[model samples]
Target chain A: MKKIKTANYDICFGIEGYAVLGQYLNEKKYSKIIILTDSNCNEHCLPHFLSNLPTHILFEIIEIEPGEEFKNLEIFTGILQTMTELEADRKSVMITVGGGVVSDLGGFVASVYMRGIDCINIPTTLLAMVDASVGGKTGVDLEGIKNCVGTFSMPRMVIVDTSYLETLNGRQIRAGYAEMLKHGLIYDAAYYDYLKDISNIDFEDLSLLIFHSVYIKNEIVSQDPEESGLRKILNFGHTVGHAIESYFLTQNNKNPLLHGEAVAVGMVIEAYISTQLSSFSKDDYEDIKKTIHNIYEKVQIQADDIEQILSWIKFDKKNYNGNIYSVLLSNKGKAEYDFLISKDLVIRGFKEYLK
Target chain B: MKKIKTANYDICFGIEGYAVLGQYLNEKKYSKIIILTDSNCNEHCLPHFLSNLPTHILFEIIEIEPGEEFKNLEIFTGILQTMTELEADRKSVMITVGGGVVSDLGGFVASVYMRGIDCINIPTTLLAMVDASVGGKTGVDLEGIKNCVGTFSMPRMVIVDTSYLETLNGRQIRAGYAEMLKHGLIYDAAYYDYLKDISNIDFEDLSLLIFHSVYIKNEIVSQDPEESGLRKILNFGHTVGHAIESYFLTQNNKNPLLHGEAVAVGMVIEAYISTQLSSFSKDDYEDIKKTIHNIYEKVQIQADDIEQILSWIKFDKKNYNGNIYSVLLSNKGKAEYDFLISKDLVIRGFKEYLK
Candidate 1:
């Protein structure tokens, strides 16, 4: 059992995570408990959660459609209205029991309801447990813009039980793994090197790796929770990655790339840019591309898609003063942020990724 | 000019407030400035505000319809969408120049835009200057639930210029005056005595009185920013007051009560509750009723409206554990909170208020 503590809340991994979560629910004496989950987790993970939850406190389960598409202002307002209808008072606590969409939207709703109530996150997906579980970031996408509306309200507790990871498919696990890989690529070369052997990641190895990834994220987030400076490093691949993700999600002509797949491709393109624009090694960029490509198949990006993606990049939350700022790797396990990336180089990076 | 400092920001009264505001804006170097105003303030006060704003920094004006009715989810999301369209970056600052509705909605928008941004509130109404100006509470209503969705994000600064009061009509001034009376009723007997001579409140007297109201509120809010304890005193009249306001707001049969007027009636009824339930004196309650009645006309509350208002009270944000919790006065300048109030007594108090 590993207990990782961030600035405001504590995270626990494995079965012990449930123990901590159950203990927290008992101590908080909340007026009632609300469990927010997506349809996917409602089917796969909720029964297990209810059985393990040791509180007799009245709990209600609210299920939304299971996908990023449902994460919008409309869904957020609907949940708030439902909570109101349920007469959920100020002291009520919401336990978000699913992946990132559930947690992000639930965390946001809980944070803003009555100017915030206590929330506990029990992330069921690998992507959520490894990435979204920490950092105190909660938001819903607005107008096809990802995370355009949000707040930095931490949950009362975060329970990252790895047993639920068994519920995820290989594609989903690899998508979450992309964040872990990017974490290592930017902060710890040795961790990256260890994770490079993409095949045969048994449950035990994945659990420890998830722990490492969360540790890396929390460490960065704690230093700059608002993403003022150090936290921007976490957006290393997300600059181009999020743009690509948004473009594909909105276009609907092709199947949308999962977050990690988009980010995996983003990391490769950024790494390529790093080699050309900064002191990053060409060999290292090639190595990163190879490792990510091993886990994620190459995404088909046509010329038109590139233009739309670049336009989305202009609205990247990380940018300031109308300039495109991208995080670049100076070397393996080290990154620099707020670099002025010209559209020319960004286009060239896309060209390199196409090859 | 009197400067009152709260936990996170400073509030200034009179002309010097503008000096502080101008200085802060020049120092922050925000990418852009977005001035948010309600329809009333946009027409009546914007030109004066723009002329006085001593900065060459680019600014855009976003206006919403003026009224508590407009303070809801649709408008909040609309402003956020407009912001996204304006390319309002995280570095942009929002200067809210209206009454409580504008400040509440705009402050919430700025706070949640990209998980928070800099916001400076320039409150343009007397009620706003004395009350809303100090509290970091920012929110928009959901489904007619007043301020149901919001945050505690403070402004970078607050500027209270009493000159704007000249633009308000007599009813508007009295409406705001009710909150100042609330500040006195709950915290300072001397201030209450001073304000009771309502007719002779010239500009100078109003300016100093507004300063006092803000000071008392700031002291209490600073001690308990999240309203876990001391801050609950601020909600003294708001229990019944808010219900009355909401009932009138949703029911178009009667003219909607301004926030302060609803609060004025709320304070009188709660004072009655205090005398019955706590150590409060009946004489003090009569004194409050007389003083309030002297300034405001009697509101006609039909028995049905009373029942509806009582039901609205059940959904009060101050509620906990499916119970109605109200702040009651023990005497003038003294109060207690989290007291469970019965429906029978609340109904009787409304009858007393009618009488």
Candidate 2:
């Protein structure tokens, strides 16, 4: 619970991260300690954090509005200007205290300021704790291009304190569970079995589960930090998942689907694709479809939605030179990456998903 | 000469870079080859480079306007859009075929596109050949903040073809020499002695000198790629030099001083500061002053310019909290970094330069 050392830095659990943060500040004696947070975290998580921090170093807060629209070059420039005004030199340590949006943009700010500076992540959501805070990928969107500019830079350490989950409603925490489900599906059948049919997720049990989920992600990232080969497996649900997420985001009538919900749907359909194209068991595909439907409300991908969804799927970043490449399941608890899938199979999967 | 091995990649000499590039293209068989340049390089250096490339690989060009005004996030985003349209995938190699502005922006494009792709620099300018091409410092200016967004990424190789220097004027080449003089002032006194009193620089000899200049920079850069300490010596003239450059940049009454002109003036003033604050020989400072004055037209810094220049100096990126740090001379050919010089000494150095 103290610290789990990975390829680049340690991932500290709960209050142990605070203890380590105190030690780190005392030893490094950075020119300044800057806290990068959003207005949401500043209101919700900051008080608990500041009271618990066992350090004498007075820190400064750089708070941005809590949303993705604010994550761009203009905001990036504003942060730099603030840092310049604060005289935050290369010796400054920027501790990001919020969810993925905060860390994604702030981590990038830390990485590029003066060609790079040190950063520590304090993930405040279940989703961020399990996924965004574990990996080194940090970037900001450009001209509406998502993560168009980024660098793979690890933080000095990651602090995942599950107590922050108390601030979130059920839907928010469940959105994080989607990534944990993907982690288990790809690596450990035993882990997947525990969560596959959960009638209720106990908060205390979920903390231990989040720890295991991060450990899985950290292990994969350590082996392939830059996503050359092994790391592509992590994109299993994201290819179709992101497309579905984008589709719903554009529609004004439908409520915005939580990322975990869209990804859950992606997993079911992709699991179907795996059985048809790869060595995945047909029975496993059928089981996934039923369980995912039972867990989350089914979104109708009607005949009209089919073509638009297919277009979105083909636009995956992994696609190259007119070929669509994907991470599909070869078997339960194992994932195969960079598999080229045809458009017909995708349409057929959507047809199957609809049925 | 074929190649000079640096810490990360080779600094290919003349046509040898093209030959190595041919072999690299065949060996790597990248997803695609993208040529990033400006209208200036596309018009001037592209044809000669194309004929000598010795490769069968059909490459596409991503050209932009040819000036610093065009080097910003809008341009950076446009290039990304063009690359996306071209299907320039992760395996694509972006060969920057121009001077610093092109390379600074293009190199950054290559480094960040798909979270970083392969980049090869083909520097067409003399200043870029010996300095920018040798070090992997690629970035874009943001909202008047110079190099506010960048990454310390090395190229696969640098193509330093001297034939491109034919397109430059005499002032352009001499501008490059100011940096060469700096290399000798910091790391090699013997190198300085060779160029100090040269009344006329033969083009043939200049090429050889440029090779040595790049070699010196690469040596210092390799030892400290991220500028922890040793690499700061490379900024010997740059601290005060940048201030002078910024000052003149604002004045519409005067023609823009070439970058080398500002740095030459900086080297003289800082050399004077060195003699006062450090163990530098006064005779060496006097020799540098007289020789530099003879080489470049001395730009007068009247009493009015002093306060503005002083303001710019304190704004040095190396300055932390409120202290001004610089790379000052400890001796001839020996530079000491992170030297804290008092304001009085800096003012005295300027007074000496004016005298």
Candidate 3:
């Protein structure tokens, strides 16, 4: 059992380690077992999952459609209703077994249902294994606002099994790898250089990357669980990233951006902003830009699109008192938050991206 | 300042003490201020409240029509939307006024909006002042289920000013007092005796009763903030009481029972169950019944109402599996939870209430 201890809980990796789920369930003595998953994972991964678990432990499976579209309150409310119908009490354990959407929505449901119940995260996607599953951040999107309503509540445990990654398509893997790159870019320059050779990495070595990403995030969150200070560094690309994601999600005729894909672009733009305003070296900024451009195709932000994105950013939960705040890299591995970036500077950053 | 400190936070009492809201705001330096109130409080109390605050300190007020009916997700969504439109951020402070509905709904909004903002509760009704405002239990009722969708997130502070009670009608006062009496019945025998001669108590001295009730609740919550053990005692009457409350609230023909009124009846029925099964002395049970009957006007639960209420109890968040569980009194000032009772005995308990 390969186990990593976080400040509050443990993240167990591999089949043998996560198999302790049965042992945990027995010890806790939950009244019932519930598994929340998306349709994709349910068909592709749940069977493999159930086989690995201890036999004779009856559990209910709740499946929703796979996509960011399902990460809304309407779907969330439906799930809560089903849990109520099943008579799921506080003693029941809800295990989320899908990607970011399942982990985010299921975690939010567990945090709020009956003033919160125990939740276990079984991330079936690389993106979730590295990012969403580890952090205590749980939420559902409200009215085109990304994570507008949420809470910081840790899961009982997070199971990181790389075998589930076999079910994912190529784009899904790249989408998840984007967040893994982010972990290195914002925290460890050496790791960032190592991640640049991701194309040459083998599946057997992927678990190490997942562990490293989760460790960085856990260390950040352990210092600031409520996100009052140091944790904002974790949102390195997310301020602009979330706005871009929302723009695509809410608008018609726009191609939807995967969370990590959006953040990849967001990091490039924010890196440019950092070069102009903060002490970030221009050489380092170009390195970040080149690396991101190599992996993610360019997302054109037209003048009209820029206006809408700025509007979305203005209403971002991070900004306060009508001032726009962004977490920008001071250098390749260090970041600073609460930086009051002016609209002109933000527009300039986007214009620079266009060039 | 009459400040009662709980495990996580403090409850400040009196006009002068709670008036420090201005100072607190100044020291904390919130970006903006928003007050959540009901129509009744808006008309009767907002002006007085605004006057008490520091001049030049502006705040936005959002008012909903007062009632338990508005304590649902739809209204909760609307409130979240309004906060987003107003661009309320993590640095903003939300002060909730009115009764249980306002406190519960507002606290929930604050808890989830941008993953939580600072919440200061200025409880306007007696029920909220004593029970709803103190505990971190923030939520909304879901699809006829009471507090099924909620979270245990404490407010930044709770301000108890009895002057708000002057606006409440007599029924509302008694509704709040029911919880106060419950505090005594479960933990303090002397206070229970003090609650018995309610009619003779001076209104000017109401503050003392309010303080005592809050103290008892805070002590219980401090020990078991999550309600897995010692905190279950607070649910002594609430198991049956909540079902009865939900039954009336969901049915069109049945007049909705105020929380404390439903609780008063729940105590009588539960007293009988305790005497029969949990070693509660017959003499104490009779004393409890007599005291409750004298204070609260009888709410007749017809034989027809039993089946539905029973169903409600079975589905309560507190119970698990096929068995119905409740916190039953062992004696006055003592109680036990996870008491598994059969349906036949529950029906007999209701019959005993009717007698």
Candidate 4:
């Protein structure tokens, strides 16, 4: 197991690491234990997770609906009621055992339950183990407003086991890889270079890359856990990426874009924005765009849709004092914040991504 | 202004202190501002609050239904949508302008908006200005649950204006006093003695008591912000008090008990429990009971209600590792934690309170 500690949070990554959950919990001596899971995890993932635990331990399980739709107040209240019914106390520990949706929702439930409680993240998906598990962000989306309600409560420890990835479909596995590539583009040029040559990799290799990405993320998060400074770099491609994700979501498209997929598109457009504002080298920018296009299927954006997406930029959480700020890359590994960009420039970048 | 700083939070209290909000928010330079209020404060309280602010500041006002009924997920989402439509940005500030209900709901909104943003409290009621405004605790109630969903994000600054209390009803004013009494019971014996002779005191003297109560609370919060140690003392009367409160709430009785009123009854009963188990003198317990009964009308808890309330005791936030731990006063100005009392003792305490 690899232990990564930041100023505000600490995370553990590896296989079979979940067995240590009871021991760490024993040390904290919480008055109660609550396990938060989505329906999918309860069926496919929990039995395997429970097999490693001692039978005598008494705890309650709160199962929420299975996807992003369940990550709202209605479901949040359900978990709160379950905790109250089970008599889970403030000294109790809440364990989130699922993917990004579960971690985000469960982390939020733990954050608000009695104004916050001790929480442990036992990520059961590749997407969660790599990206969402490292950050101290916990929240759920509101009506048409993604992640409109939430908090920043860090878990005491995060346990990641690669065995869960074996259960994921091919689409899920590919979706998870997109975020790993994002880590490489924003921070490590060498890691980006490594992903370019490979068409496919096993979970073992993916685990190693995930470990490195989490290490880099934890390092940045340690310096700025509240996303005040250094942490903004992590949003390199997320600005436009999130807008694209929301745009596609509203259309009732059958194949919903994965978070990483939206982020992948976000990276390309943001990289183009970086080139226009920071004068990043043309060759490096091309390489960044080409790498994403070559691996992920291209998403088409119409001119009118681009305008709508640009309007959504105003709602971006990063905007301060009404000015839209973008995290731009000066080079592969170097990022600059507070890069003021106008509507025309964003439209121009969108045209380039569409081309 | 009385400025009290603790390791986890800071409390600022005084009349006409709303201007201090500008200092903390100067760093972000917010564009548009949103102030959240309830129906009760909108008529008589908010105008006095707006008189102090600069006329040039751009802000929008959003009001919700007054009281605990509106403090739920439905209201939280409605406010979030309004903020989104108003184009509230990261640098946009949310000012909660009411009593505890408004502050708690507004604080929860600000905490989750864009994964957290800066918030300010302009508490109109005496209870909020003294207690809720000081601590970073922000939340809304779930289905029949009190403060079941929330976060602990500190406000930029708290504006305490005693001028608003001029319009407060007699019961509301008395409710705020009960919380002050709680501060004295847990931390200051001298303050408790001071309140003993307040039978004929004017409401103007409440400002001084508010300051002292806020100071004592800030001291204890600073020592243990997360409620890991000294903070437990703050829950002195809350365990059985909360159960009693929940019991009254679920029944939908004619006259719903206010938070402070239920707590007053809880303090009296818990003091009785302390007399039985700890070094607390029985005379001191009687004094506590008499002091509360003199100011507030008595709440009737039927004999049949004891078992139900006792069952709800398991849901207390203070429970740790499956044990129902109660915070009891050992003596005047002193508190103890993790007191394991039998079910019969609690039932007897309830029986005594009914008399």
Candidate 5:
């Protein structure tokens, strides 16, 4: 087992780390258990998880609607109703077993159930295992707004068994891999170098790389658990990435860009802004752009579209005092905070990405 | 203005203290604002609040259905959809301006909106301004379970304008008064002495008592924000109170006990438990019983009802390690924790209350 400790959170990774579930449950002495999952994990992933549990233990499975749109108050109510019908009490524990959406919604449910209850996370998707599961962020989307409702309730334990990755689709794998690459670019250049030959890597190697990526995120989260200072570094690509995602979400014809895909593009564009304002070399900016573009197909950004997307920047969660603050790269592996880049620079970055 | 400071939380009471709303919003630099209210408050209390706002500032109001049944997933979704339609950006703040239900649901909405946003609570009801507004607890009810879905997200500011209580119904005023009596029974003899003549008090004096009650709750909360230790003292009457409340909820009875009403009875019954297990004087237990019976009508507790209520105790939020933990007062002004009194003792206590 790989024992990883960050300032605010500690996570254990590897093959049989799944055992941590039973151990923590025993320690907390929860008598009743409820497992929350989506339709996807209920069929493909939950059986593998259930095989490890003791048969005598009484537990119930709450299946919510699958995907991001389902991550809202409707599904949250469903889980609560299920818990109520099953007579799941305050001593009951909810075990989330799916991707980020499932964990986020389930964690929100547990946090509010009778004002709060203990929960354990068994993240099935790579995006969740490396990022969502470790942090204390639990919430669901509201209407067209993404992640509009949530809480910062930490789980008692997070069991990440990469064995679940075997069933992930190619699109899902690549989407998750984009975030891992981001961890490398934002914090450790050594990891970036390791990820350069991504197309040639095997699944086992991919899992090991994911563990390392989670370690970097875990380290930063532990130090700034509340996202007051160092934790903002984890949102390196998210500033522009979220705006781009929202832009696509508002447009009817274009396919919605996956979270990691949007961030990959965001990293490239923000890198261009970095070269303009900081000591980042032209060569380094090109390398970062080339690395992300190699894996993520570039989306077209027309002049009109650039104007629309720039308008959404003010809506970014990090904005304060009417200024859109972008998390920029001061250097290849270091992130700088709270830079109020101008609208012209944002338009210029979008133009550079289009080229 | 009454300026009171607890160890961690500060309570600013009185009419002009509502200006704290503008200061917090200006300091946080919120670009847009939305005020959440219920029908009751909108008609009776909102004019008092809105007249205080700057004339140039435009704030949207979202009205939700009032009462415990409305505090569910359906309303949570309705509010989310409303916020989305209004284009409530991440920089927008949600100001909850009603009783406990509105504050709880609105705070939960803010905690999850865009993964979290700033929320300010302007509590109108006496129960809300004193008890609900101070704690960081925010949630909605699910099925028959009260506050089953929630998060512990603190508000940027909690504006307590006791002047709103002038419009409260006679029952609403008495309901809030019960909680004040509870604070005295568990932590302060002087406060209890003050509440002895509570029946003769007018609305203006009730406002002063509400401030004092909130002060006691805020002090307890500051010391144990997470409810791990001394905070359990606040649950003094909640154990049996909650069970009785739940029991009544399961039946199709008219005029079910409100939260405060059930708690008033719970205090009486738990006092008997305290007398059995500790240095609690018989005189004090009888006084508690007689006092609550005088203010609130006694509900008949048959043998079958006691068994049903006892069964519900296991589901209490404070339960740990399969053991039913009760917070009992060793005497007035002192509380004992983790007392694992037997079911027989609880039944005996119920019998004592019956006599």
Candidate 6:
């Protein structure tokens, strides 16, 4: 069992999953327990979760559709309404058990319901375990804008269990691997190199790698939780990546890219931009692109899509004083944010990615 | 000019109205300014506000209907959408000018829109100037539950100009006076005595009184911003007061009690409760009742309404671990919170109010 504590709360990984959770449940004084999950986790992992729990604990199950489509105000408001109708109060605890969608939505609901309530994250997917469960950023999308409305409210606990990873297929695994790869590329070169041969890595042996990724994220977040300065380093690829993700999700004919997949492509383009604008070595940029491309297939961004993506980027929360800001890697494992990237350079970066 | 500072921001009263605001506007760096107001303030106070501003500072005006009915999720969401449509970003500054409803709703919108934006409160009502502007408790009602969803985000500044009070009717002045009177009863005995002849006081001469009330509130809030412990004392009259306010507001046929009017009655009943359960003297209880009745008309709470009010109190955010807690005054100018008041005692207190 490994416990990494942040400034606010403790996050546990590689522990006996149900036992740790059962202990946590007994520790907190709650009137009722609510488990928020999606259809996927309810069927694939909930049974194992229930078997591991202390028996006779009173809890209610709230399951919703699985996907990014459910990450909106309507869904968030609906969950709040349900909790109210259920008479959930400050003493009520919500254990969100699913991927990024569930944790983000449920964490946000807990933050605003009667001001706030106790919430615990039992992340079921690799992406959620690595990213969503760490930072106190909780929010839902507004009018198709990703995370346009949210708050910075930390959960009481985050329990990461590797057993749930077994339920994910290759694509799901690859999607989560994208964040881990980016973590290494932006913060730890050696860790990035270690993940290069990820195909042959045993699933059981990746626990240490997951812990390293979470630790890197935690260190950055704890230093600057409000994203006023240092925390922007964590948004290395998210600027363009989020734009690509939202662009696809909003279009009827286009299939939305998974968060990690869009981020993977975003890193490639941002790396190219870094090499052009910053002291980032060309060799490092090429290496990052090659590693990410090897793990995740290239996502084709059409020439016409560039305009739409830039439009989305223009409104990014990170931008300030009417300037587009991007966090560029000056070297492997080192990033600096608040770089004013021009539209011409961004267009060139996208052109280079197309080539 | 008198300045009162809290943990997060500073509030100023008795300052040169437009000049102080003009200086505040000049001090902040904003791409554009947005003023959020209601119909009442737009018609009554905006002209004076505009006339006092430094010319060439561009701003947009967003107006909504006036009243407590506008304080809801639908209106909150609508304001957020409008800000997005207007491209109100992090650099945008929102100057909310109106009563408690405007400042509360606009402050909440500022807190949550694009995560948060800089907001300033230019309070037009006495109720707002004394209580709503200082606490940083910004929220809207949910399903008739008061402030069910909100956040504690402070504004950049709160500019309290008593000149706006000249536009208020007698009832508006009395409504806000209730909070000032409560502030005295709970935190300052001398201040309470000063307000005993509130009807004889002139609105133009009440600036120092407003300043004192705000100072008392600021002292208590700074000590306990989250209401985790000591801050609940500020809820002295609010427990029963809020229940009575909610009771009337939620009923269709009944005329709603202004926040202060309901709270005036709540203070009278709570004083009765205090006398029964604590060191409060019966003479003091009758004194509070007579003084309150002298200022505001009696609000009749039917016998049947006791059960409904109790139901509302059962879910107040301050309650924890399934116990309904009340902050009862032990004597004038001092309060103790987290007292577990039983239903039987609460009924007796209400029955005493009826008598």
DockQ of every candidate structure = 0.88, 0.55, 0.82, 0.70, 0.50, 0.57
- Candidate 2 residue runs with Cα over 4 Å from true position: A250-256, A312-315, B250-255
Question: Candidates' TM-scores?
Answer: 0.99, 0.95, 0.98, 0.94, 0.87, 0.95
Candidate 2 lDDT over A162-211, as tens digits, reads 88999988777877888888998899878887888767669888988998
Worst 10 residues of 6 chain A by lDDT: A14-23
Clashing pairs for model 6 are: none
TM-score of chain B of 5: 0.93
Tens-digit lDDT track of model 2 for B169-253: 8898778789889999999999999989767578888888888998899889988998888999999988888778767765667
> lDDT tens digits, residues B1-355, model 6?
6788777777877546457667767777677788999988999999978876774567888998998878988888888888777777777899899999999899888877776788989999999999997888888877767788888888888888898998999999999999998898889998898899976687655888898899999889888887778988878888788888888889898888888887888888888989988999999998998898788877777878888888877667777656777889898988888778888888888887777
Q: Highest TM-score among the candidates is held by which one?
A: 1
- Per residue, candidate 5 scores C-alpha lDDT tens digits across A328-351 of 888777887777888998888888
Error of 6 at B46 (Å): 2.3
Candidate 6 chain B, run of 10 with poorest lDDT: B12-21
Candidate closest to the true structure, highest lDDT: 1
What global local distance difference test value does model 1 have? 0.88
Determine the C-alpha RMSD for candidate 1 after optimal superposition of all C-alphas: 1.0
- Chain B TM for prediction 4: 0.94
Tell how far residue A210 is off in model 4, in angstroms: 1.6
Candidate 6's residue-wise lDDT over A1-355, tens digit each? Answer: 7888998888988556567667777877577788899999999988977777773557888888999979987787788778777777777888899999999999888877877788889888899999987888888877777888888888888888888998999888888888988898789988888888887678766777888899999999999987788988888888888888889989898987888888888888899989988999989888887787778877778879998888888777888666888999998988999888887888887887677
Categorize the docking of model 4: medium
